[model samples]
Target: MRITWIALLCLSLVGCGSEGGKTGAAAEAQPEQTFSWKLVTTWPKNFPGLGLAPEHFAENVARMSNGRLKIKVFGAGQLVPAFEVFDAVSQGTAEMGHGAAYYWQGKIPASAFFTAVPFGLNAQEMNAWLHYGGGLELWRELYEPFNLVPYAGGNTGVQMAGWFNREINSMADIKGLKMRIPGLGGEVFTRAGGMSVQRSGGEIYTSMQTGEIDAAEWVGPYNDLAFGFHQIAKYYYYPGWQEPGPTLELIINKQALESLPDDLQAIVESAARAANQNMLDEYTARNNAALIELVETHGVQVKKLPDDVLAELQRISTMVVDEMAAENPLAKRITDSMRVFAKQSKAYHGISEEAYYKARGQE
Candidate 1:
């Protein structure tokens, strides 16, 4: 009887051990969640600089996350229209978007401050303000209401004035002119007696060719050459007072971002920083070569804006910016921050970058 009882006890313990082993195995077998995202951009597919920045960003994220997070980038018109990028990302149709913040000025009046201002910060100064001078914090606050997060994606340093069918020899020449421009610069143009029409980057070439616009300003020589603007317009003007250094943006859906793991979030931010710097470097090198090609091979006439015209435009730009600042409390806050930064930046640049350039030209 005792031997039989001992055997039963041993079998019972064995059965309990088997059950516990099964439960532990099941717990260990739970699968990890992976994320797949769609990023829509405002640039054409594989276009240099602007388009490539987002492409690089997507690649960086994928590589850093080791396939745990994969992002597929779509150019403008692929998943959504260029102008609809902001809305698409906000509504979760896309997890992310790439474009200029000024494009959303109609939705948020303070947004233009994040992109560029008339006679505002250059690329170097702009980057400093954004990264170190509290500009990024302000930008985040402005975008918070839209269910989106903003990051500096790229910068087109000191854009060209524009290609014009008619020469703007004097301030009076601007009157009744129809031009493709946007942001606070567009407002300044309108106040100066020109009609400022909004057109997407892809639409400008056709619009200018078809006589829908008499003048248009894209980025600079590198991008403008790709569109063959020189063929349609006779005079290429310089000193893009409108957009000295316009910063493009990477806007991510807030909910989507919060879903990312902490490590993946850091990867995304670091990648954006890399993409941003890469674009400016690419533009600097490519623009110089493209400018030479435009002047030599294309026989493009590059002219500086007349002093009187520039002076008048500058005056008008001041008025337009001040009026905009007065209209919105947020605008005032942004404008105040920008002005303070610009003043400090200009003072240093005057003696350093500006002076050096002047001396070099004389040599």
Candidate 2:
């Protein structure tokens, strides 16, 4: 009986030991935990800086979080169409989206201030406004209704004006000019006597090639090269006045964001900030080389929009902005906020940036 009792005790202990081992192993294998998320983009798969930045962001988040957070990136049309990215994330179809903020201006006109504006602050100045000038707080508040937590993900810097079939020499040249443009730029263009078609990156090249569009503007040199705009259009214009400092944003579903623990939230935010900087750095580095090739090697004819056209567009931009402010309360508030910050920023930049460039030119 004693021996049997001893044997039973040993058996019970062995079973308990096995159970404990399994539990311990489970705990060890599981990490503080691992989570998977889906990120959809407005660009094609791995489509250079714009597309690849999000993928790199996901990887950085995963690696930095030590496998606690895993994000899978889907390009345009993978989970939803490009324009649908923001809506999909808001509706919980996707947890995250990558795209320019202005794309959603139809839903929120104020959102345009976050992306870019005609003759607005450039990339460096935009970053300053967001980080220092209460811009981020307003941006977050604007997106609150849509249940999106916004983050500055990337900036394409100043884009090229566009590729045109015909040169624009004067204000009259802009009349009836149909261009594939979007967001506030399109509205501004319409006010300037041009028609704007809002189309995705995938559709723009074809639209231009088929003469459906007189001109089309995408991101500057690198992306323009990839899209083969040079092959179809001979006249390339410079100084992307429409999108001086177009900023790409990451839209995270509010519910999804709320579900993340504090640490994970920090990870996401940190990763976004890092990616934002990385994108700007990459674009600055790559654009120089690409511009050189576009001019020297590719025989791309680079030109500036006529002085008359710039003057007319600027005047129209002011009018359209005032009209937008008058019609949409939200647009007014955002525009007012942007105008306040931009005024101060522009003044400072004039004393600093504009002056430096002028002096350098004289040299």
Best by lDDT: 1
Q: Candidate 1 on 202-227: residue-level lDDT in tens?
A: 89989989999999988999999998
* Alpha-carbon runs more than 4 Å astray in model 2: 1-30
Judged by lDDT against the true structure, how good is candidate 2? 0.88
Q: Residue 140 of candidate 1: its Cα lDDT? A: 94
Pairs in clash, predicted candidate 1: none
For 5-37, candidate 2 gives per-residue lDDT tens digits of 767885767354465545556656654756899
lDDT agreement with native, every candidate:
0.90, 0.88
**How close to the true structure is residue 235 of candidate 1, measured as C-alpha lDDT?**
89
Q: In model 1, which runs have C-alpha deviations exceeding 4 angstroms?
A: 1-32
Position 38, candidate 1: lDDT: 97
Per-residue error for 34 in candidate 1, Å, reads 2.1
- Candidate 1 local accuracy as lDDT? 0.90
Clashes of each: 0, 0
Q: What is the Cα-based lDDT of residue 58 in candidate 2?
A: 99
